[model samples]
Target: MKRTSLIIVSVLVLLSIALTACQPASTKVRVATDATFPPFETVDEATKELTGFDVELMNALAAKAGIEIEWVNIGFDPMLAGLSQCQYDVAIAAITITEDRKKDMLFSEPYINAGQIISVQKSNTEITGPESLAGKKVGAQLGTTGAIEAQKIEGVELKTYDSYDLAFLDLANGQIDAVIADYPTALGFIGQNSEKLTTVGEVFTDESYGIAVCNKNADLLKKINDGLAAIKADGTVQKLEMKWLAGQ
Candidate 1:
């Protein structure tokens, strides 16, 4: 009888262990972003807090998905590498969903639409459009749609900088005739340097910005897509866009 009791007790212990093992693990998501672009992702100079549309959007998505996010801020170029290395589950930078990028990473539905714009010194009025920019030096941030767009234009001397701020700085110094950048980013730069720079009347190419995730993580991609749909349905995305992008 004692031997029989021992066997039953062992079986109960094994069953309990199996049940515990079968329970799902808590979900923790890590997000990486380039925090240098204002209105999308920028680091507060004083508080060092990452704040902008993308930051807020990611937080909202995490709340809705019932997951905690480990936010990692790094350079733009490194962000893509980190995503490929699986260092983060998603990238919320203002990354354009382009065919080339789609070759390596999965992209969620575009959170925002962006267009290329021209930024010229306030004193210069001769260059008004792409045709006028011929033979003039153009500045753009490296690895950005702006750079790619500028390269497409003939006769313009394309100069790539590490950051938009740097490109804007060169433009301010008269080293570059104009800077090509995303509309929101150009607006932010113009706002800060209203005395020195202004955006051209014409906008160039239009592109959609998306959150990038690992190509293999279909489950997380689905969660993000569902959350994005819900936000759009509730008009949250439009509201945010109006708050951040429309006025300027």
Candidate 2:
């Protein structure tokens, strides 16, 4: 009996080693984002760590996909450039999906719907929407859909900023006449400075936000889409919306 027990223990140990050897190494994906956009992605002032809707959603997706991630907070345009070069495994920064962008990188299924809107000083009534912006100074974040929309309006003096917060600041200081930005992002700014700014007119352009992956990383793309689908089906997306954008 003792000899039989010893043989069984040896077999079990070898089987455990074989199983461990068969398992693949964990995948660690590098993710990029511009943390300046709030409610979607932002750095916590108190903890100095990244926080917000996109950050939380990505964390959930990473867990679901069984991958480790390294977050890279970078400028919006730089992030795009890096993503195109396959320098990062994934990016999620409230990036809007467009045909032009689709040419350069792979995009996961859109996760959020955000449209462009015009914002002006509280006392200003002259500017109503895109039509009223002719010959006016309009600010938009560089390399964003808002910038593209602002450029479509002929005769407008377009001022591009690295981030929307700066553009909104300039608007508040009377340096710019209007700011064209994603509706929820504009709402994030307006929520903080409600006394100084308000959005005018309806959302002019319909846009959807998506997670970006380099064309070479189809496997990662699948994981992201799969995780996104899971989150959507499990009500995680709705819960995030309620947490970050409920009253905005």
Candidate 3:
């Protein structure tokens, strides 16, 4: 009777193992980003929901790939590190594709054609271009190409803000002479205060925004690329560009 009971227990354990092995894997992808940027990623103050070009495009991509994702808010500077550390499976917040960043993380193909531009008060007639801002106060988003461009201005007082909104506020409040930021983002701010601000210099630098995916998860990279290609081929990309960047 003891031997019979032992045999029954072994069979039950084997069955449990088989059942566990047959369970499907989780399909949820965790996406992280710094949501402070606008026209690309920003929180709606009234509804407190993340909404913008990047958010919309990401949602579309996920739907096309038949996967679900949870968006996690993170700081801009730490986004790349977060992906490398496995804290997030995907990162997208106006992340410009650069050789330095490409060394550490795998980035998706260019999704957004973005470039840096300058914004100054409408009444500021003395400044016409990048050279005019020399030796004056300029604000830009921290850790961004805008900030990098601002730093290159000889003898300029560069104030790096955490977001372009704050930088624009300072410009509106007379704290700075001009702001350097991406054209689309700067345009969003100008739209809010069209009378107060206007873009002066032509696009200063050429940069393309890309989605960051971890090198460890190469499969995810392929999935995003495939989805992005489908969207671009289907004219969805043009529609999104018109929606977010038409006025800019």
**Against the hidden reference, what TM-scores do the models get?**
0.89, 0.93, 0.88
Q: Rank the candidates by lDDT, best first.
A: 2, 3, 1
**Model 2: lDDT of residue 50:** 98
Q: Output the lDDT of residue 217, model 2.
A: 84
Q: Candidate 1, which segments miss by more than 4 Å at Cα? A: 1-19
Model 2, 4-67: lDDT tens per residue? 9999999999999999999998889999999999888999999999999999999998888887
Tell me, what's the RMSD of every candidate?
Answer: 2.4, 2.8, 3.2
* Structural RMSD, model 3: 3.2
Better of 1 and 2 by TM-score: 2
How high a TM-score does candidate 1 get? 0.89
Candidate with top TM-score is: 2
Give per-residue lDDT, candidate 1, residue 222: 88
**Worst ten-residue run, lDDT, model 2?**
60-69
lDDT of 1 by residue, 11-40 (tens): 999999999999987668889988878778
Clashing pairs in 2: none
Clashes in predicted model 3: 0
